[model samples]
Target chain A: MCKNALTEEKFRELDSYVDTLPEKHGMLISVLHRAQGIFGYLPKEVQLHVARSLNLTAAKVYGVVSFYSYFTEEPRGDHIINVCTGTACFVRGAEGILKELENHLGIKSGQTTPDGRFTIDALRCVGACGLAPVIMVDGKVYGRVKTGEVTGIVKEYAEV
Target chain B: MSAYRMHLLVCGGTGCRASESKLLAENLQALVMTAGMGREVQVVITGCFGFCEKGPIVKVLPDNVFYVEVKPSDAEEIVSEHVLKGRPVDRLLYVEPEQKGKVSSHGEMPFYKKQLRIALRNCGFINPEDIEEYISVDGYQALGKVLTEMTPEALVTLMKKSGLRGRGGGGFPTGLKWEAAARNRADVKYIICNADEGDPGAFMDRSILEGDPHSVLESMAIAGYATGARFGYIYIRAEYPLAVHRLEIAIAQAQQMGLLGERIFGTGFSFDIAIKFGAGAFVCGEETALIHSIEGERGEPTNKPPFPAESGLWGKPTCVNNVETFANVPPIILKGAEWFASIGSEKSKGTKVFALAGKINNVGLVEVPMGIRLREIIFDIGGGIRDGKKFKSVQTGGPSGGCIPASALDTPMDYENLTCIGSMMGSGGMIVLDEDDCMVNVAKFYLEFTCDESCGKCTPCRVGNKRLHEALTRITEGKGTMADLDNLKELGAIIKDTALCGLGQTSPNPVLSTMKYFWDEYLAHVVDKKCPAGVCTALLSYYILPGKCIGCTACKRVCPASCISGEVKKVHEIDQARCIKCGACLKACKFGAISKK
Candidate 1:
């Protein structure tokens, strides 16, 4: 878990979104997504809230959220860096990029920076095999990224 | 909203993105604005047009003119001639070889004519995130019908009558599973959506979840209603964040719309979905293993027949259906079973969504009728092989599927047709292999995947697969004897016959398929000590032709193994003992100096 947990404002923001949703039987997932978007991590209290709101058990809600990798319970940094490590990317030196990113950020994939500026993660496929060595910072995709480019990319985010 | 103008639907699939589709869109936009009919023209960036070889695709609506291979430079001409002057861009249009001088609309493009698009209905049309858009297109109406009017039994009967089978492998009847769980004597029943698609190159479920997530949610709720289950769980792999995110949003929207939740449409029936993530394990796709993972175990398949329908998920009766199977439910209920039953073959009902990948041109998501011929999909729909490469074989059903050689291209794709030809439709992953791909190497690739992803619960999968991989590794390295091939076949059969679960049972498919279809490649490796496709490092040697050498020293400079010894302006010689065959020399050579033999 990142040190910077969900602030009260973020919780309120998520609550507001949840309040507007119709009380559907399958709304637990939607609630968790909203919580993750606002809080960066889904805290236990929010999970309970989601369960209560959707008329589900907290265990059930936790089970669903915990089942997928996209739902995180730890605060992420300002930038989320996802490196594609699928078959094509792996064959095209994506592992080298991951190693370089780890060295530069001093954190492994799935961990947020201590100062909370970047969260690095490895993905199976971003569905962009034509651009084998691909990385996405935020929603912008940078293709054919090399190990040499890792320093400049991380520095740009860290300095921000 | 001026009715006098046209609509240009551009394919924005990932493949098109690679072909600078974004640039095409930009140029189209600029051209539309400059024509002073911007208000009349609607340039919509739609998801995958499916005709990928001739992409980035531009489709003109109202008239429905299809344009293929639209580059950025051609954008101005398309806008100026097609949109502005109402003249077709003849040069940019897809010229069908059979059609001769005639170009066709998207529907007339043979790839889509034979196909049905039930699972992919909303994919290329709707903005995936906007609930209102989905609603306008009759998204939650099925939920409304089920909640307000239909009884659980009625819904299940509709599904059974529709003859819908699970699209995510096994081909089990969807309604039967629900009915079994409904009949089971359990206080707390559950519905599980198996979105933990672990098949290599399979993305049909993920793409559906990404493009039209609400359908899956609606289907799960429908399943919940039919089975009398209060809770639903979608066990999607952690690998698909986009699917996960979209699924979450769709659930929220459905809740907001009163389609889900307690007293849905004033009915006492209620079912809510929660997501469970599988942490990079392929075997967890099995129902028992998935249940164990949801129970926070290490995701190893357990003994069956107390089958999930009878006992599952904390020891309650649970019904598990794949994402594609659930996706077929609402439509069956809405359109009636006979409508779906009428579309597909006698045994298999409705459409199957295949992740059309590998050496084909239009590598994207495709939903075809169950009986559509492989030739139709690969040649007609996929735009043939890229750059006119001769097709070798098409590998269906991921690692578990067999390779169908070019001779079998005319075979129809259904549960029976695939299984009859030494392959099973495990999940819809169709990888087209070209002539350049070595059969031995292809088998080696699938074997390697199974080895790493095997759960190691059973000796057959864990150990037998390791042995098969070693033989393939040996064969690919040009060191295997004829005895090794015999050993490979024996071990593969053993794993298939004795393994406890589906993972082990189907682990031998790649080797079996390649051996069946590309035995010559294997013979070449063993008998001739050569890799036919120049893929195996041990059978290949990098040589510099004295005539082609420009004395660039690029190969010598980049050799990580330090085996290439050469001076400037001179031919280079590789020390084969030190060369690890990483192919750095092949990539670094500028003057075609390096050739592999």
Candidate 2:
């Protein structure tokens, strides 16, 4: 579903990288991680290329990718706002925060906004429950976030 | 080295860092430099202090005086008043909840009084990135002692003599697990650090790895020498980027220093470690599932007749241990078995670290000796319930654990006692609940997690948990009858009894525990069709208290549904039929007129 298949530049990089790893048994996961890193999200085209390079079935690669929540099958937005719905956050009004985000972004948790600016994802507890009602944009964390502050935070990111 | 008489150690843990401890660190350093006492005063940024409610904590050295809720603005006052004039910033000092006085030292504070840090010994004390800081605190001496002097059998005996159980939920004896792996003679055996902690509120493992990674690496090498294994894999969650980043630096530094990879301490034994990323599967926390994950499979658990110790990781013997478990190893070796054994209760040994959160004043990581009562943890260490609310229940062990009622407040927190009360001491995620929290909703929250994370290989966990979630959903949505409660009870018991893996077996804990302790709440949901805590949206009804309504049209303006219609300065009324019960109007009402009934 990508624009073409893989570009010549991307193909050469991937092919050489696969040669460096063991193709026998345990290198599929490593290759998949690298592939996902190279192409922001793992589309079917990339998965197929990985299968061919590693000499594994596309079904095998797809099975592993679909099993984990980290790998995505589609393209994501520039910024993914992960609001922690972990037990502590949930108790500390995380749902309200999520609802506010959904309204402001004009999309649900899984869907990327039409402009491809932001995507909302609810993650399980991130072990920072001490900062309950926690949200992370990209990798930076915003703690003790209140419902009132949601609009200002989103406005700041909207320009970016 | 500069002669620094006073050392101000600040909390650099994730929780404190989020609250601007970095700014506080920078500010303190700036103020100290400006005062021309830079050499005489050292401002060091360390890991968590476990008193997170009162963070950006700055603990002064030599006297052990702990300052809480330290701001960047307070740095100048602290330096000028305290460092220069020999007087503490009384406003920044932590106020004791019990006595309402100026408690100075860490020991006098209720939060740190009962805590004894062993696994977290180096955290909040030294810089985790520095190898020399770790070495100064007797870090790699355990690996050195084990490699040069003691035999494999002697070390296992010492581990067994000390009553150190695995801190990773199951309370499996660490010594016995190592001995089993050691018995099976395999040339390419592997040692695994189970850093894939999937519990929602838990972060002790992440904190240990982020704050003190070398301790785990040193202990892993010791494990390799003892078990006749040369390769080790740390199966860590990918979500913890900071911990992962720190671990990478630590491993490279250790390998460069000749602590890991090829003949550690110049002995004949050689060991190496590699990082294997876990891609968001909670079931991988199980050893069998973890092994499968490493092998690039679906991370599904199998029957344990071939237990990981006998056959694991490409069919070779493997030894699996949690991060906190390995962290305790070096100290155990340094201070002998008897010395470690004398710290805790009969069965559980060494101090246990808990990620204490929810409705508690001091929300942070705490480590206390085993057999300490919940009263000490909740009231003493946790500084009681937040906003002066009444304590309802405490959920231990995350999604796999059960809730202990307020009646069991004095219950000693150990593996056996928690199990006796229908909960297990799961990787130390102690979330305190207040009176405002609904027990039925709490049970639903955990069931939702288990249902989503069930490996789907087994029927009881995959389907049974889904059914249990549906039953709970019906109850929360005010669509359930009394008979559904029996259905939930029967289904939860069956899933607990017949599910395949440890994850499947414990999946129904939240439901079963709530059923046992909060049957009254469940009965109210079914019989009365009301949520006492006003949490369930389906059961909530908006009512404008006419007596309290001073009516500035505050609720009317923000109402998305436009249900609240009233004049400028009169009692406002909510149209019941048009109301969607989003609670936006309730939050907007400054006069406290809108209340959910």
Candidate 3:
């Protein structure tokens, strides 16, 4: 209830944004993007609110959410680390880099740290093949990342 | 119009931007101002130069001096030496890998020697955010020419004669697709630019959208005119923040300039474009799946024949084309179809943009003629394999494509030839592999991707691909029988025959192609339980060579599993049962005592 009260303003902001859209026929994906942007992750309450606002069933919204990998139901950490597992990176020793990060963070890919400080994800490709063996810490790309340098790179965010 | 004598074009592509080219641009601007050459010099941030191997690239006009690997600190030297004294910096010039000489001009570099730049002509040349820059390069002239001078039928005929096929993996003729859409009767229709770019190692589409977005938009409007569609949508990936930003600016600029909005050129034909963001679904790269995603569905594909050309996007006729496909349209409309068809091989006309990556010396986007040999692309244009290593194989296409071995290196690259070699040009992702890469493991990697990305709509894609992936996993884990190889072939053919969508049908390519070319690698894994490349950890064992051991404790000290047992000044031995195969000992061994087989 307290969480609800805290996020009431965010829901209102989302509602007003939905109202401003010219047509709502095929705006579910865009509206959900906006909702996720506001709420960090989509809980049942947010999905219900969106369903009610858009005159859609809750099952429909949940189905759409679960279908896309980008949408998450659970909350994430302060920083998200995405390791590039694309072919270009894979051939250039991306698996070793991923293993190093897992050892450093004490968490597997797609799992958040217990302290909620970092979450690591193995992304398919971010399309920066020029910089093979790439990783992104909160959307700031670091290219040609070596296995030994993984610990040092994570320390910058951990310390802050 | 301006009194600026020297123009500095800094690469602002995603690759260079990752290397902090933004800061480099700002630093160059500040230094130019400090040198009191603000009136004489101008610094402009342009899109990708495609020379991403040696970025951040800075090109100076008038002298045509190209600098590579430039840092922010180099800004002062550039403004002072190059801008003021008119002398080019020697240390920053790109040294040819073979010649070992400083190549100052971009034209002299071998990387740019055997290249064509129709789709990417304006990428490194102009600021993508400026409409004036695009207009100056004859960007929207195609749209004006189509709307005023030519009729819809003439445009369709011109496209048919051009012989341009889709650059998005499938070599479907673009002109024929437009003709089908034009034949359909509907009051409301749609034009979709497929910018999803779902290929794992491909970034050409993203580069075009980031570098010359107006070209795509103008072509989309032209497509709308040809197909009788007044509304358009660009289905793009949300992960591409920079491309999305540039597109928003390009659309707003075009609309403000009366080029995109209603009654463009004050003609009766009107067209408008809006962007729809994709939420990380690779299956959406398919036209039907892409349409469903735009309609806010689950991005799953349905059967075709009621193709989007007939019924699409709220039950309206729609024509969907890839970003590279649309980028090639304006040029075809401006230059006659025969002029465009004169280049490249028969059946597949014009050049193709390939994202050349992985194990290659030059890992960047390259646009070459259709009939160019794979040998030329890998050796001449790509500067050969990195570190002078022996060439093993190259994986063309993406997960849906196959690997071509060294024997097929001379095969001319085109839709027919690549398919004939058991590999399709899927979205033009050419990933070169060296001797260190394991063919069986590479096949397993792609199967894993397909199993994950499959929409799970049809059983062949959902369950059949899963079974194939399981067989691949077992082989890679050294727990396979020779019978598994036969099963993989049978199951792969079944999936290809019965799968509903393009993604599912082509999902078995990686396995089939690798089986066809690298059969010995698989036989070794199944019969001898040895991974020839030593990539599969389950098939590898580490040991210390008694001859090479200097009795050093380096390997023992760095062993994470504590499996290496030895004392100071004593030869070390690895406990086979306890060794985790992390390879830390091999890296830590200073005397080269540790080896894996």
Q: Give the TM-score of candidate 3.
A: 0.98
**Highest DockQ scorer:** 3
Q: What is the C-alpha lDDT of each candidate?
A: 0.79, 0.89, 0.92
Q: What is the C-alpha lDDT profile of model 1 across B144-245, one tens digit per residue?
A: 888788898888888888888888788988889889998988789999999988775666777677667788888888888888898898888765666787
lDDT string for model 3 (B303-405, tens) is 9989999998888899999999999999999998998999999888999999999999998889998999999999998999998888999999999999999
Interface root-mean-square deviation of model 2 in angstroms is 1.2
Error of 2 at B312 (Å): 0.8
DockQ of 3: 0.81
- Candidate 3 displacement at residue A9 in angstroms: 0.4
TM-score, A chain, model 2? 0.91
DockQ, all models: 0.14, 0.71, 0.81
* Clashing pairs in model 3, backbone N/Cα/C closer than 3 A: none
Ranking by TM-score: 3, 2, 1
| Candidate 3's TM-score on the B chain | 0.98
lDDT of 3 by residue, A1-160 (tens): 2332327789999999999998988888999999988888888999999999999999999999999988988788889999999999999999999999998989999998988889999998887787889999998999999888999999999966
